[model samples]
Target: DAMVIQNPRYQVTQFGKPVTLSCSQTLNHNVMYWYQQKSSQAPKLLFHYYDKDFNNEADTPDNFQSRRPNTSFCFLDIRSPGLGDAAMYLCATSRDNGNTEAFFGQGTRLTVV
Candidate 1:
């Protein structure tokens, strides 16, 4: 069974338009992470919520924002998506902050037009 679920597997948004990608998990994991991956590149950690505590990566752009209202849900909001912002957004969940096996969603492929 899929523990982590990301909705709208493929999304197309116009340039400068805002879009939000959602993820929900059944595992009740404490850590939920959002990553951005470009073609042939490694996934970059955008941010994560560790049980209500939000942690953002230093290099993450201001255009990206995230919300974790509760344990099961998390959302990534792109304020003004540019062409370069198009990527595959992956949602992951882990039991803890320490080294642990993480469950990943199928991911949402975003296209900025």
Candidate 2:
């Protein structure tokens, strides 16, 4: 079974519409992260949850947010999708900080119309 998985590898939406992308891991890892990566750009950390500790990147936009109800699942919520929000949304998991390597899911490619 896949350790991490994202459904609907591609998603399309109209401008100003709300959308939710989900992530799940079977590794029992405590750290889960959501990153948005644009063309050729580094994956920018939107937010993460280390157990129940939520960490959001300073530059992340207000339109983006995340949720972690338990150790195995997390979700990214976009209140109002914009064209600029169209990018690859990656979900990752790690055991901890520098000691472990993070694993990523294929990602959901959001296309805002």
Candidate 3:
């Protein structure tokens, strides 16, 4: 079945170091989003690309950034992952707005050392 995929199910990085988490999908969806979730907290929308239109959440940290070079691929880059940056990074995709449902990847668990 078509779905989202996140690489390196877990990532370990030192404080103030850069890291990149990847996400891709076979769903052929028009929108892809990156979310940061800590423990049992609600997933926080970082940013998303809707057919190349990048929409960033107002509360997303400056240390976080995203890129989508094409339809089925997207990436999350952390300029400097802090101790608090340690969290589960999820990638999700949706067909369109309104009546669409999002599918999530297994997620990359980031651990700041």
In candidate 1, list every pair of residues with a backbone clash.
none
lDDT (10s digit) by residue, model 1, range 50-81: 99999999999999999999999999999999
Of candidate 1, the 10-residue stretch with the lowest lDDT total is: 96-105
Per-candidate TM vs. native? Answer: 0.99, 0.96, 0.96
Best by TM-score: 1
By the TM-score metric, which is better: model 1 or model 2?
1
**lDDT per residue, candidate 2, 37-109, as tens digits?**
9999999989989999999999999999899999999999999999899999999999996699999999999
lDDT, candidate 2, residue 113?
96
Higher-scoring candidate on lDDT, 1 or 2: 1
Q: Which residues of candidate 3, in runs, are more than 4 Å off?
A: none
Query: Which wins on lDDT, candidate 2 or candidate 3?
Result: 2
Please give, for residues 24-108, the per-residue lDDT of candidate 3 as tens digits: 9998999999999999899999998889999999989899999899998899999998999999999999998658999999999
Instruction: List where candidate 2 sits over 4 angstroms from the true fold.
Output: none
Which residue ranges in model 1 land beyond 4 Å of their true spot? none
- Residue pairs that clash (backbone atoms under 3 angstroms), model 2: none
lDDT of each: 0.97, 0.94, 0.93
